[model samples]
Target: MSSFAGVSVLDDGMLCPSTMTFVSTSSDCGYHLLVVKGYARTKETPNGQSILSHDFGVGGYRWSIKYYPNGIISDRADVVSLYVHRLDDDDGKHVEAKFSFSFVDEVEWQNPVYIRGMKTCSFSSDASSWGFYKFMKIDALERLMNLDKDDCFTIRCDIMVCNAENDAGGTQVLLPDIHRNLNNLLHNKVGADVTFEVGSDIFSAHRCVLAAQSKVFMAQLFGPMKEGSASLDVIQIKDMEATTFKALLSFIYTDSFPDMKEDEMSQATEEEAVKYEMWRQWLQNLLVAADRYDVQRLKYICEKELCKNMCVSSVASMLVLAEQHHCHRLKEACLKFIQVQSPSCLQTIIASKGWQHIIATYPSVLNELIAKVIASNQQLVLK
Candidate 1:
């Protein structure tokens, strides 16, 4: 035993905010006009004289307002009176709601900082209306809402209908669909601030979204050189093809490759075989473009597709691509293909001379691969 007894210690008794748990509420705002066709009838109307607004719905309930011209009571005649009437079922069921009314001028401000009295009201069959007797002074209302000059003024009512309380598990919500919305934005070009010119093809995009996705784009669009392309003029991209850039944009907006139905070479005829070979070349060009733009995912995708389409003729070029684009796995795959071939088989492949393009472009890479082939053959003889 310790010498401490069952004594409670308070760490400097204090009050602070705790996690919030409360009932949810659904709310909507509806605007209705309080206009005067002429100054005469507006002022001449007797006290308690009211005009009704067309019905508007809020939170599944129909509501309309009763606007009293000279106030509902005699003593309050100098002010305008407004009452919101519920036109829903008159059954014993009651609705617990709170609402606020403000002039249109206040609601349309940069920051609507209007205030209203507190307290939620219960509306039942017997009590179906709630209101303010002194909604506003007639003279002040006219000045704020431009009633005297505009010939009409509007009032806004914001209603909050309380929802049922959630259990401890809380409420389930819908999944966020950011990709679909971003794709829509790309097609719509509603707030596009930048335009790209690839050869003769023009494309518009938002700079912020591009910056968020690619550091290369961020540097060109917002970094030190941004001053040159600051205006609406098109920024030229000379090296990339229009099709490749289009696919890049699709990935940027949707984080996915545009759906492509790749031809399977093993099952394809001679015509499809030609298309399959063309696809392999496209992947090479696309990989180079992705690397230039620093789009790592697209670059990796290109590398993987090239590896899947690799053949004896593509060995030399694939080896060069592997080194140039940081494709270590692809390099290993290419080396493995070389290591499994017999010395005579390699001679026949070299005789075919299908790798001449890579040999002309990257002679050293082919030479190194040839050396690896000789080393693997010598080891096979020793085995």
Candidate 2:
């Protein structure tokens, strides 16, 4: 009988589905909580002594959570006891139900460590209280109090009373897709107060969004070194291409990249290869732009993609790019690729078109490569 709670802004400001994050039960299900004040003092009560909780209502029946700070049994004296008490008279009507007893922290993320009552247990005249004799160890309870200065603790009970009418099916509720809002903002150009001129193409973007995602944008758009403080002016980007910038904006808004049709590599058409190379170059440029902007996640995505595309033909040039961009992981990968055989594989890589550029521009990288080769031989010798 429960309905969708719609979307809600979390404490961290991200929009999320209320059903999963806010509520975990239907209308038929209900909750009961027991807050024991001066919880540490309860240890003096000794074994077999218990403290009954205040009454709570669920499924038209009066119920109370039972707590034993110093356990209800002799052998289990070191642990606390907990139970659900059926308070109403044993009417034999609507007495079947399921319940969970869980200890939660202040920030109530779902704890997997909870005791769920057997599904549909009958609350008959034979039993008024049914629960765990040893719910939580006293040491665990002490650790809970150490998290905060408070002398209090709480145990929650979630109850779902069974019904014949509810046996048909559960209600269908749609979860909130939060990214759709950002997608709409991006494509619809709502509140986009900044423009970028990249070569022949112009893009509309939000300054705040960009600043939040990239440190370069933060400095240039809102802080010192601002380029286009006046919203009417276009910020000139001399280096990045339009396609690369577009993909970058996509990632900033939706945290997802535009789909690159990499599967088309099998087709091997002139047009397809051209298209693929066009995107490949864009991806490479995207990494450089990401690095410049100080967008770590985007830079990581670019690095991972480049690594997946790495081959003998491109590893040498990739090594040079990695060194220039300060991409340590990519440099390591390329070094490993060439470290196979210095005379054969290394020479083959050295004969590639990019090696001449590397020799002329980055002589230090050549030294590092030789050092890596020596280290590899040393490791082999040691083994």
Candidate 3:
């Protein structure tokens, strides 16, 4: 039960006498009363103001005031309260109560304590009362206050949608393309251990990788998850040398690669073209690692380089290699390159001991090569 006093109401042309009080019967704030004063607003404000102002409850509430024929005004009967009243029919028969009273005052506060390091703040419609809601932690308090603040500061409260911006910390989360569908994954392990910290402090809690088949190099930016398991799209890197792996890890922690200069790419005796080839091989190893980790951009770099060094000899070997590793796209690309450059190229390579191994492994492919070779030689016969 709850109760309050100092409420006032007004009556007709003449001031009436009536008083009402608040009484809480149930678990919640129940009813209120108003004490009516005989006269309401008669002439106007004592200062001869055009419009009269009543300072009571804040905005979003009803105001009840009444005026009598005589110059006298009743402040009691003019009171209005939102609390409901439940009186028996026999208790009162339209008692001509003219005035009523109800008092409403806003409680002001200085600076509220701010709660720092809040990871999340949530709310429910029927979970708590207004008083309880007002006294939540500063993070929650801030969330509620955000309701009154500018749109920019308001913490979006949708349960399904996460905040669009990254956290203030170094955490970078790559979200799935189907953000709506993947919302449920937040509760999963793949979601929990995800976090990012720049120097020492964590800036973000999750950085999601969207594409399942894209190549990624987590070691290049923000070291590996260290504790959780992850999936990758492709695996190009075979066994990285101990030093190379360390270099890659360092790059991940700090966005800087080691001093891999052009001069260092080859020995002095090797041809300049061979030097480029060495660099290309080194890059291919890096691409393998990147592709295995689902880093799409890195995979593209590897493909670009391979295309630049395109040749009939390498295409057949690349096709066999790509197929062996289940690199469907890469295999198709290499096969297409062979078909376009020289259709008989694979048959010629197959006769060599080095490539005969592949032809034996794929006898059906050998038949396809023989047909292509015969077709190519048909032009020679016509000449």
Candidate 4:
């Protein structure tokens, strides 16, 4: 965070003003208050014109509020003239907004005199302002001013800006692309600094990116207990296979799973079945890896992928994996696949080698599955 210090020229030859220096890094859909103090005592020239406020920012553009106490033209001399004008270098640009201008009563703050309806307008260089020539009668304004003890008045403007244009009829500015370029940089592996050795496999990555993305990575690679390295450093990862490590790195970098042909396992051929089985095994391993690394998004992705491929042959193993990883969604999906979607799937799963291991390892999960089955049998009996 940089402090604003009036005006300064950058090395890039761009003049930066303190007021316009801070652009919000996040989305903002809110209101800005424009309070004009000493409004009743504003200096009015012989031409009956006065500028109350100037150079105020609202929705990334500069604006001013002009006031005429005795009206701008001779024909409208009995009334006040009030107009909100754009002062920014938005030459061909148009700003659309709905605004209200009102005079605040000092004694009864809630009972301020408003300009009736909200005035909606598209401001451009040609049609810059939308205002009322007869904002209020001159005599009424003077009486209101005299009633106040301090002889001071307040005027407030409430503006709700919708959007701004590049030109008068041009395209609107789009939202910031937060992840697009970051994803591209990761995919390209550009300027990679650190390397990880998982088993016999080596993965090149950026340390800053890894540290920024994950707290575990930050602790291991950049914290006080970090392995000191200058550049092209190789750090060994324990208790994880090369493939699982690669998948974890892919998610860390791209915020998505790595590109794999097995992701599209639509065919029913023996070859496709083998590929699908491999994919499911990888997802199961990735789920455990995600939990180990504390990557919630990757864990969710793995859980979803495992759920999609759950069958009689894999349900018991998946149930074991879900219980071990504490993936409630995946565990529930496994239970439903066995007990509800296909009750016969349970018989095959119980006979599998992993079933005895699940019974020994996760007795509570096995009890939950039995409860679901007993509940299903009771429902069948009732029918």
Candidate 5:
């Protein structure tokens, strides 16, 4: 016989003569209670060693219990054998369960023998059942049978099925053409509702699209303190380039940057160089505009591009821009390039014309640079 520790017996309506209840508390667990009757006088054929109970349903599957009164194995001759069998064809399906086989006492009607544990069983054409060959001692079963009223006993199997197929059923919807449609709308300006005049250049765009993408646009266009001419058809923007504003509108509509040739600078003539320089300046202005308008993704893309183009001459200017616009990654990259990439890069940056402007404008940035230098020296001394 097996011994149990820390097992609690239920004395309420749990051990009734004809009824028992099993409940699964887990949201993903399913419950089933199987009851077996007739303890001592279970019918056995002359040559058969075990008897099968009536089949029960649990989680859309049929199951049955097989009991051996004597013993199924030679080594476990002194104990009774018990097994749970899957009656239906699982067809490669797997079932998990926590079950208990109990022998209810008739005299007390409360105390019972319980054999319970969590188990995982897989179904195959070869074998479809799992259990213990030595379930309980034959002497213990006989003593329990003697205490019963009409040579009857009851056993309960509590099953919790997990990972069942088709448990959650629904159709999923997907949109594959959304990006292309939005990009076309942005580039074509098919249904333009607003026009922005920047210097001598004018661009047509949708106000709703801008308002949806940016809180600053929303406030300027629809909030309580909106500008007087914002309700008009044309709104003029000052201190921003037409090209930079166009790029910002493209990002708002398409949620991505417009594609550009990577080798434009490498193959540039004098005219192409001027055009590339204008585009680079536009990107810097767009970065400042993105931060002012609270467009974080645009700011992130600008920071990444600036970090990629970092040179000794541009590092100081990039640091000033990072400090002014609160771009932490770009600021850290500029410092790292100055300190680690080349020691001479620092002197070169300090000698730049923007270095005096940086000290006059951002004293905190100078403090941070000094702190990094001190920390680096301390690490070198310790090593």
Candidate 6:
């Protein structure tokens, strides 16, 4: 009597049978495939929340619900399933079909009459029209197939739903406003304000602050305190000189990316300049600060500038900064500059005691250059 049943025809001489061809009503549901992978955790919670981490790139509609629906299970199963539902329209309009898995080892149900090949509607009126057609003994199958025990019980179904679409663009749905989660971490500190002898080296202090969020803002407050009359108010450092202070504040707020100008080294005494040996120390400090914050793009920008203005004396300072901060790319650039131009400017670096550090840091390149120098000792050496 149902539409799925056969229709009979009576002829004058004999009886004949006819039936409706499967119209694929399932495709209308928009479910392409469903994969259910199961796993056990220590208690109930797990990290990474991934059951099948090894098998990546297999994607479907993924959602993490606390418990299985239908009130069938008591505790969290740690069973995650991906439902590949087709995009379909219901009531002559677009809608998404909801599909879930029923984890069972047996292919057929007895007494209740759940069985493979039986139209799912006939066996269980409560269930959907499509049901299981195959039995995969996952645990037993794992041994037979020689798979890891941890990877055993995974079941997949090629789903057929009505009104499903073919193309589904993948996108990651990021959780909103996650930065607010670290607000307490940035503001909370437990220790007393002990007097610490701060160094003039910006890069050194930048490293300490980067290790903890609480110290970052605190370190910014004390920047001008070392210069006695330069600052008076504890809180007024925020409104200090627009140019130099903004560059310093840039490092505090985002780490690195200080504005470099011609006047950056004008105030330094002649003796201290010789010790640091470069007027570009502030720029070098910015590179270090950028590295601490993992601001890689800013770090590259500073390095590019240093390489563009490469000089024998400046190259040594950059090499030291690169080595101290593990900036391998910058260190390589410094070595290449020395190899290319140091033949003519070799005495400039040697006079400044820069060659010793270069030789110590990059022994192989130093050896090759030294040999080249000896080979042309008559012409190049002016001892």
Top-lDDT structure, candidate number:
2
In candidate 4, list every pair of residues with a backbone clash: none
What's the TM-score of each model vs. the native?
0.49, 0.53, 0.30, 0.50, 0.51, 0.30
Report, for every candidate in turn, its global Cα lDDT versus the true structure. 0.64, 0.67, 0.35, 0.64, 0.62, 0.37
Model number with the top TM-score = 2
Please provide the root mean square deviation of candidate 1 (C-alpha atoms, Å): 28.8
Taking the tens digit of each residue's C-alpha lDDT, what string does model 4 give over 1-383?
11111211111112124333422212212222233334444423333665444345555666555666677666657777777777764467777765556555454533422233233468887888766665666766667567355544555555555566764466564433234445566667688887888888877888888888778778777885575545337788878889898888767765645655542553578988888888888888888888987888778777866776688899888888888889998999888887764456657778897888887888888689789989989999999
Instruction: Write candidate 6's Cα lDDT for 1-383 as tens digits.
Output: 00111111222211222311212221222211112222222123332222211111111222111222111112222222222222221223222222333323434312121211111111112321222111222232345334454432323232221122233633232222222223222234223232222232121123234334334343443444234444322223222233343344344433323433333333357865554334366567666655654555556666755654557767776776777777776776776666567455867766655567766776665665566656666566665
lDDT of 2 by residue, 148-214 (tens): 4776655667766554222234422222323546767889998989888989998898888888888
Please provide, for model 1 over 3-50, each residue's C-alpha lDDT reduced to its tens digit, 9 standing for 90 to 100: 111111111121112211211122333333333344434556689876
lDDT (C-alpha) at residue 205 in model 2: 87
Off by over 4 Å in 3: 1-238, 242-270, 336-348, 351-354, 367-383
**Candidate achieving higher TM-score, 1 or 6:** 1
For candidate 3, write residues 1-383 as lDDT tens digits.
12222233433322233423322222111123332222223222222112111111211111222211211213222211121111221322221111111222112221111211111111122211001101122232235435234211211000111122223423232222243233334324254334433233322223334223222434523346422435322222335644444333333332233344533443445676577665656655665655566544445445544544545545655555555545565655655566555437757655555366566676665566566758878977998
Candidate 4: list runs displaced more than 4 Å.
1-180, 187-191, 224-232, 341-345, 380-383
- Which candidate model has the greater lDDT, 2 or 5? 2
Instruction: Looking at model 3, report the run of 10 residues with the lowest lDDT sum.
Output: 152-161
Give me the displacement of residue 382 in model 1, in angstroms.
Answer: 7.1
- Of 3 and 4, the candidate ranking higher by lDDT: 4
lDDT of 6 at 110: 25
lDDT of 1 at 55: 56
Root-mean-square deviation of candidate 3? 29.5
